[model samples]
Target: MFVRNILSAIIISVAPVSSVLAAGGDTPPIPSQDWSFSGPFGTYDKAALQRGYKIYREVCASCHSMKRVRFRNLEALGYNEDQIKAIAAEYSVEDGPNEDGDMFERAALPSDAFISPFPNDNAAKAANGGAFPPDLSLMTKARANGSNYVHALMTGYKDKLPHGVELSDGQYWNTYFTGNKIAMAPPLMDESISYEDGTIETLDQYAKDISHFLTWAADPYMEERKRTGFKVILFLLIFAGVMYGVKRRIWSNIH
Candidate 1:
């Protein structure tokens, strides 16, 4: 009976103090981030990313710009000269000489940077309501969760929220997005890409693939890094084994 009264009194005292201390209300949780395929500041799958490249080319190229990526960068992602040439030819670049024996706005070649859909900052901001659609060449690196954020944003879009999170009037849920609310409407759906191979188009798979591909585009040397890391681990294991054997042999003499 005495313990119960003490506990009740403690609870009553703590409740009021807790309420007063938390006058600003609770903070929202940081969005959970997925790092299933990340590596350092620059990493991911080459082949999957290559496929993602194809998706970007066939779909995303219409609105977004990968201004840092050149047509030749596709070759690093696994394309041949003919493919690169064909892709490069699809876009026209402007170039001309000036009075100072220099050139500007020269016609784009395979080596040129991917062109922004809007010509300049003023035009881009004017069109996008002050939100310059960012050059995606390294967006994965710039943002947290890197590519998964993109995947989530692309896949995110439903009429509801899972729970706890209150949806704003225009809010949409993305499975991969941090906080599950995103601005871009779902960009991919199953069969969004028409592959002659008849690969079943599932929205989930496309989002995953394209996100992975962008990861690759942002960093094409992932395979090389993985192979090198494997070699390093092997070398360390072998070195550790040899040192252990030497220690045992030295102890045997002392014993």
Candidate 2:
């Protein structure tokens, strides 16, 4: 009985992976892109983050929410207090009741979290044909190889369907999404957004920018963490060298 129970647990775990492999057999591997913030010493590209924020605000914000991010967090992307306030004011958020005891809506403040496009999940799903757009705050952290996954997903749409494949009404075909089917339609196109700094406005560039931005959003403290780690390692090495020298001198005198 115990052996059977172990077998059942193993089967349950392996079943999902096997099913995924079967469903995604035709899907190409997600390609890794060179990111400015990839290595232990790597830091975020501030320009990319700003561009990414622009994309998020203008494009993805219509469907997805960055609930974990606050407007003041734009400081990391080099936005000044005034710019952040202006950006925040463009959106409205639900605020506390007045003396009348009624909830009210007001201009968003820098301290407020990013407002959802929909008031709730059901409303979001209703708007998107029964598909709930996910909050993107922790998206890069939630998925395996999330940055690459997001980039691939954003650029993987196909207008032509493979043989024997058909999409349901709201579904679209993507080469990188699991089962080659995704609820969200292709959300980007060439020249969809114009960059004042003259960055290329291609789909691939848009994907890369948004992926970089989401990665930063998921781990804003990555550079600080890396710096602290380097400092700790350097201190440990110096302490170890000092201790070794002290041991050698003490042993030399004893001998």
* TM-scores for every candidate against the unseen true structure: 0.67, 0.89
User: RMSD, model 1, all Cα superposed?
Assistant: 6.0
Reference-based lDDT, residue 18, model 1: 82
Global local distance difference test of model 1 = 0.68
Overall lDDT per candidate, in order of appearance = 0.68, 0.91
Clashes of 1: 11
Residue range 1-255, candidate 2, lDDT tens digits: 999999999999999888866665467779999998988899999989988998998999999989999999999999999999999999887777889998998999999999888888999999999988999999999988999999999999999977667788999999988778889989889999888888999999999999999999999999999999999999999999999999998899774
Assess candidate 2 and give its TM-score to the true structure.
0.89
